[model samples]
Target: MVLADLGRKLTTALRSLGNSPVINEDVLKKCLMDVQRALLEADVNIKLVKQLTDGVKKQIDLDNIGTGLNKRRVIQTAVYKELCRICDPGVKPWKPTKGRSSVIMFVGLQGSGKTTSCIKLAYHYQKKGWKTAVVCADTFRAGAYDQVKQNCTKARIPFYGSLTEPDPAAIAYDGVEIFKKEKFDIIIVDTSGRHKQEDSLFEEMLQVNNAVEPDNIIFVMDASIGQACESQAKAFKDQVDVGSVIITKLDSHAKGGGALSAIAATQSPIVFIGTGEHIDELEPFETTKFIRKLLNMGDIEGLIDKVNQLKLEDNEDLKKNLQKGRFTLRDMYEQFQNILKMGPFNQIMGMIPGFNDFMNKGHEQESTKRLRKLMCIMDSMSEEELDSPEGHKLFKNNDDGSRRLRRVARGSGSSPKEVFELIDQYQKFAQMVKKMGGMGLFKNGDLSKNMNMQQMNQINGHMAKMMDPRVLQQMGGMDGLKKMMQQFNQSDGSGRPGRGGMGGLGALGGLNFK
Candidate 1:
């Protein structure tokens, strides 16, 4: 079973507790059994699964009969914590400070995505203002140098590899030394991928390790290997000092239960997980957020961090316009751009509460298509029309302005009606933004502060009206909508790691109008 399916099964089992006439021992036992079955089916090691469920059972004491406490919530929370516990090795990985030179070594079996992961890690740090470089020392594999050269060229990160260098250690030492001399913040050394039976490759890894003396050694694990990942990870750990692990091929369909189990076997923390084939698809792994996202509870912290990474140039402009109660078509266009830049459409939707289930397989593709089409329609418009505060009126469906709408549709290869749909969505966003502005929500430039509960509900009510009725229904009506917004606001101000002012735009993106 894939991780998503396992999460669903666990969620369903927990939700069953609410349906029970009484939260008694038998009911709890049934839920535990369901949880155990789900984990086992996901290919989690049998021992780990048993320990997780037993730990959850031990935490819940129905016999204590604490008055006024919701047993269902307690039991569900226990299960959630236990799930997180099994996935977390509680070991903090080494981090390189800015302006300091550091070397990282990559080791993994062939086809484990080790090469791609090295590039992804370099790109990740590069984006964060670090001078990152990659060194390819995989002389065992043909074209290894070319692969690193090609990807690094595309990512604009400096890379060192030689087609003629027969000694991997020489290449590794030279690459690290040169980057260190240039004052690079992070230098990643990509080693030859090897299997347990390949003693020669292991010896080569040890040689490179001694030459570069990497600050951290990352072992990449392919999540598609099912329960065998534990053994494979153990094999790698036994051969070298693996300080951190990165699980690759953990996309939606991957069976990642074994990858999670491998954490225990390797005794190393997972620094990141590859979610897709794209270079930007790697995400830093946080146990609580991962489990929460898996259980369909959403990850506001992750969402905020993603938005912050955008560092949108005109965020101040957007915030000022919202404060002035003026939202233009250009504002909506920029937000659409932010959403697209935030990573995959489904991944963005999954970070918002109540959107995971709504953005399932087919629906995600359709929504992405629709979003892109809307952007295309906007692309065909003039700057005057896009930046105009008149919004939908700029393309009014009347004799005088009808030509403008038709022109946009024709230019975008879309129907006039489709153009109107885009306009309508923009109008809804405008209305929500205007209402929020009127409530002084943006006056202080903080979306999470200085708003009373009444004001929050008022804005939530307005937003609820503008959202797709089906989406609102799936979100559990007005109460659920209110709760979701409150959760977002609370998370925003939790002193967590996220760039401020991004929340203003982040909240706007969450108002998916279908």
Candidate 2:
């Protein structure tokens, strides 16, 4: 089962407790049973699953229950805590020092995505202003050097690898030396993973480890290889001092549970997780956020981080226009561009609370295509039409807006109705922004920090009118929007990650919702 499915099952189990008015032993017992069943189906190691359930039960002391204690809340928290313990090794991950060269070596069995992860890490660091380089020392596997070289080249990361190098350790040593001379802050070495855990492979890995003396040794495991991950992780940890773990192909992998099992076996923290083949798909493993997203609670923190990384200058321009209450079709189009940069829509929706279950297969792709079509429609407009709040004005002032709409539709290879729809969408967004601008939300630069509940409710009421009737209803209407805002406020007020002064998003700085 996927982690999202496991989360849903566990959440259903927990909700059963809430449904029970009497917090009796039977309810708790059934809940634990459901949790155990879900974990087992996920391919979690049975022993670890038992240990987690046992821990949760031990945390609950019904006989010693105190006043004002909510038994349901206690049990839920205990279950969440136990699941985290199962995945967490409780060891500190190695941190690269600023201004000092740090070498990270990747090791794993063949086909474990070791080389791809090396490039991902290098690219990740490079984006953060670190001078990063990659070294390919996988002499055992033919084309290993070629793969690493090509991936690094695509990312523009400096790389060093010798095709004629017979000894991978020698190549690793030389690569490190070259990068250090170049003052690269982060150097990643990708070693051979072609052989099984035999004497020669282990010997070579050990030799390379000794040669580079890397700051961290990351053990990459294919998450689809269930149960075997534990032994593989143990074998690597026993020989080469594996410091951290990175599980790849977690999505669509029934063995994600087994990947968790490896963490306990190696006692190494998972520093990152590879979700997809894209270089940007490597996600930093945060325990709370992982558990939260697993349970479909949404990773608002991650969503905010993604937006912050965009640094969208066009978004900043939209923000300025919004503050002046001069939002236009041009500004709406910029917002669409920013959304595209944030990655797939459902991926974004998955990070929002209460939206996971609503997303359907092909829905994101369809939405993306529609967005492109809208952009194409905008491209066909004149500069005055593009900047005007009412794009229909261009046609309405002369003939029917239909004439201009038809011309745009033909140019953009769409129907007049579709062109009109884009204009309608722009109008709704502009109206909402104008309303927000009048509320003085951005005047103090706090973005409605001073607004009371009544004001928020009034604003949402109007915005809700501009939304699709079905979507507005699916979001629990105005009350649901208010509850969502309350969740944000509570989390931010408590200084949660990506919360506090950041507000709804600096990226959403002058957006109507902000």
Candidate 3:
């Protein structure tokens, strides 16, 4: 079972009790059995599965905590906690010191994606204002140097490697020395891997480690390797002090559950997970957030981080325009840019409860393509059109709507109807932003600030109109939305859902707000 399947199965097992009037030992036993079956099939170790089930049982003390507690929610929460516990190693991963050069080393088996991960990590640090560099010391692989060089060059990151040097240790030492002298804060050394565990491989890894004396040694593991992750991790840990682990290739049909349990066995923190082949696919892993996403529960904090990141990319002008209730085609284009920067759409949607199922239905790519097409249509428009107060007004003026639309369609190679559709979208967006701006609640998307009952109803009504019927039904229509908002308000003490959806971005329906 893949992790997604595992989550579904475990959650399904609890569905039996979700509506049950009474819970007894027999029902608990059955639920545990179902959970055990799912975990075992997901390639999770037998011992770990047994431990998790036992923990859940112990935690759900029926008589001790009685009917006063919602038994259904308690039991489900118990399972959720135990599942998250299995993924956590109960220790913090090593971190690089700011303003100081931190020598880090990457190690893994052949084809485990160590080189790609090195560049990914380097790019991650590079984006965060660190002077990061990569050292390709994997002389054993046939085209390792070229591959690393190619990726680093594409990312515009400084890289050090040698085509003539046969000794990886010497290259690693010299690379580290040069980067240190140049005051690079993060120097990542990509080491060699073997087809399988061997004395020669370990010896080579040991040589590179001794030469560089890295501050952190990260062991990369292929998630698809499943049950073998434990042995491979142990093999590397025996040789070096593996402080962090990065699991790659989990976006396949691999039984990722095993890797989680096995990595836990290695007593190292999982610092990141590779979700795809793209360089931006690598994401810093948070145990609770990861489990929440896996179980189709939202990762609110992660969503906030993504929004914050986009805001840091010079959104002051957009914010100012939104404050003045001025949303134009240019604002729409800016929103398109923000959508792209928010990482994958499916990943973003998965952070909202009930959205993972929506994504799994295959709308992720379709929506992205549509957004891209709309952007292209906007790009073909003239500067006057993009900055125009009303998109439809440009076509509706004395110049004639059809002729103006034809010009745009001709330039963009899109049908006139497609251009009309884009304008229609822009119109709806402008209307919403105008309303938000009128109420003076447009301060950085603080949706609930100074909001009265009528204003809440207005916001809720617009959300209902924009939301798909299916999504509305899942959220229990307006009643459910009210409940969700109430819960959010209670927990956060912010009077309402701050950021609501899209981090603190609030309403992008007008390409407005932060």
Candidate 4:
């Protein structure tokens, strides 16, 4: 799970301890210890975790009744604030000059995912209605031109690069001129990733910076490098006015705790996070929401925003159907499609306060498969059979339920047991919705409140079984799953990874599961 997500779960568990007229010192201490343990287990820096815990404790101890804020709330808020401060380095937003194209230069060490990031950024701006072009200045790499060109082609963005041109600075200058002539709104220059000791390569980067005169210079760092990421960031900052930092490979990093700390030490605001290696695997760094999630607090604002973006209101018919506890197969199919738009199942689960921890336990893939199987079974039902309760009754009574089940099983290429399982699961879900007062419960936050420890544990256990790599292979393997995740991550200009179709399953074998 993401650090922010882990924090959210920890905070929620702490809040579960009732608020009182007076702060319970023992309970507070226990809560803090729990928080500390959770962070440590997530590979957060020990020192940093202590600093955070201590800060919260100090705030709690100094609390006054007159402030109107409960001691627990105060402590929770303080911890949230501190985490945000550390995660975000206070870097100014990239503001492009009006009526003029802005130039962005990408820099990083070798294998830090610089080239891919450049293309992704261009794609992001292009989606924002900007005419974007890419400049391949990394003549050092033999196939750099082809790589950038291919990415540009995939994104349908323009590219300017010449294999014959040996001078990096001259290429950048020409690229910029060509972009100007082409009337592109943004020009992104991709430079070769060079080490600090490579004086000649560094000099070339500086020359390109001067020649291109980019409005924004972003240093891409690998989060997997841990503490060393600090020095690399600092070295780059010293050379160029490093406007922001993009830490990549976060999805695979065990010690991602250093990610925030490194940005904190460098005094660079984290503008983006690269969660995976795909072109779209980036997310905007939201300080408040991230910190809140890390502390196990619900990001209500983020949730609201997502709801609005998805135009949930437009689906009034579906909402009404759900409110009546009359979920049909068609409704279920639409819900699956909507969830797909929201990104990966793991990511969506992370947005929930307590579920984030369960997700970090590495059970997301399993849960996703179950949901997909359920969706497929629903897909096999006819429109009339789905819409009418009587139709379902007849279908189930005639021993036709068996025949229909077999048909669904065959249609979905799944077992009849799987089809039966989906029907049973949806029946339970429908019952829960009815008990909770239907879809209104979601808006009123009643759904979250009703989610008890037992239910959460059950969900986690099921998720664990579903996400097992072996189970995924039975479905289609890592290549298929990774592509799905990439699509989920890259849904918006936020740069989350895209589900790159079904070809990414092979890469899963190399994943360090632990």
Error of 1 at 301 (Å): 2.6
For candidate 3, the TM-score is 0.92
Per-residue error for 42 in candidate 2, Å, reads: 0.9
The lDDT of each candidate is 0.82, 0.76, 0.77, 0.64
Model 2 lDDT per residue over 1-514, tens place: 1255677788888888978989988888999999999888877888999999899989998767798999999999999999889878789999899988999999998999999999999988888899999999999888888888788888999999998869999999999999999888999999988344487888989899999999999999888888788888888888878899998987556447888888988999999988777787777888887887777677666676666566543356655765776677776676667777776565565666655555433655666677787889888887888877656566555566768888888898999888777776566666666777787665432354676777677666766666566555656777766666555544532256223122243223222221
lDDT of 1 at 118: 98
**Stretches of candidate 3 above 4 Å error?**
312-316, 396-399, 444-448, 470-476, 479-514
lDDT of 4 by residue, 295-404 (tens): 54434344333433455445666656544645555655565655555555445555544445556535667655655766777777777766763333534665778888
lDDT, candidate 1, 1-514, per-residue tens: 1266777887889989999989999999999999888887888899999899889878988989599999999998999999889888888888998768999999998989999999999999998789999999999988888999999999999999998879999999999999999999999999999998889888888999999998999999988888999988999899889999998877765367888899999889989988877889888888887888888888776776676667653578877887877888888877777777878766776776666667776776777787788889989999988998866887775874688889998999999888888887778778777777776777445564667888877777777766778878877898877876666666543455323353445444444756
Better of 1 and 4 by lDDT: 1
Best by TM-score: 1
lDDT of 4: 0.64
Ranking by lDDT: 1, 3, 2, 4
C-alpha RMSD in Å of predicted model 3 compared with the true structure: 3.2
Alpha-carbon deviation at 229 in model 4, angstroms: 1.6
Clashes of each: 0, 0, 0, 32
Residue-level error in angstroms, candidate 3, position 215: 0.7
Between prediction 1 and prediction 2, the one with superior lDDT is 1
